[model samples]
Target: MREAFHEQLDGVFDDLAGICRSVETAVRLATQALLSGDAAIAEQVISADADIDKAKEKIEDTCFQLLSLQQPVAGDLRVVVSALRMVTELERMGDLSVHVAKIARLRVPDIAVPEEVRPTLARMGEVAEDMVCRVEQIITTKDVEAAIELGRADEIMDGLRRQSFAELFADEWAHGVEAAVDIALLGRYYERIADHAVSVANRVVYVVTGDFPVDV
Candidate 1:
């Protein structure tokens, strides 16, 4: 019975990693579409978000089933509990990517990112993709230290967001308020995606060490 339970637990972890990969693809493509003004790619990202959502629901159901049937204790209990929290964070990351893609879709032939703020958004996208890849590693390996180090990546994302804001307020800024608003929101979407990655990593730490980090 214990062997079967462990197998189910492993399946849960595998599903989480799969969802993380989907989110990684979503953010990367969303950034590409945003920068290149490719409405088709943006639409693809938007449509695929539903699969991420469905995967989250399936994982949640599996976690709950494990809790009720297996009654996992101690370390095993922590793994199940942390998986619940981690899935939530991953779902939100997928949603944020969808939000970025929708912004791209709205602009259609014209790119949503303005010239002055393009570099900042571009960097943010790169950082977000890298962080999600690391997240997948942390999830699969259960490396507490790698999970904790993700906080530093979140800090870099925060800095990029600030840089974007500065660009909007610069004296040479020529884009109107609407463009300014889009850039601000885009920066936030990327930053929040990073934040959620950190959250997921912290949950992995909790699964391995039974304690979350002091800093969020």
Candidate 2:
């Protein structure tokens, strides 16, 4: 019975990892489409988001089934709880990517995004992507160190979000309002994505160490 339980737990972990990977791909593709002003790519990202949502539902169902069938204790309980939380975070990340794609499609005529802000936006996306990747690693390895590193990446996303706001409001106040709003929302979405990734990392820490990491 123990052996069968372990096998089922492994299956749950695999489903969670698969969901995370789908979210990471969706975000990366959405960022690329937005940067390159590719409407077709944006449409594809939007379409792919549905798959992510379905994946989330499947993962959540699996977690619940595990909880019902196997009376997990200590670390095992943490794994099941974390799987549920991770699915929620991954789903939110997918929705954010879809939001970015929507913006990209709306701003199709103006292909050239502001040169100054482009770098910052790119960096934000990179950090978010890195955080997602780290969460995947943390889940697989149960590494508290890597989970802590996710916090650092999240700080970078926060800094970029503030920087984007400052630049948007500094000059170009009249003509740049709409563009600024779009950029601001994009930055916010990226920041939130990082936050959710960090949450997943924290869950991993809990699973490994059996204690919640202090949120700093």
TM-score of each: 0.97, 0.93
Model 1: CA > 4 A from native:
none
| Candidate 2 least-lDDT 10 residues | 170-179
* Candidate 2: stretches off by over 4 Å: 172-175
Write candidate 1's Cα lDDT for 1-216 as tens digits: 899999999999999999999999999999999999999999999999999999999999999999999998989988898899889999999999999999999998899988768888999999999999999999999998898889999999999998888889989999899889999999989989998999899888887777889965
Question: What RMSD does model 2 have?
Answer: 1.7
Reference-based TM-score, model 2? 0.93
Superposed by TM-score, candidate 2 places the C-alpha of residue 20 at a distance from the truth, in angstroms, of 1.5
Clashing pairs in 1: none
Give the Å error, residue 25, model 1: 0.2
Worst 10 contiguous positions by lDDT, candidate 1: 207-216
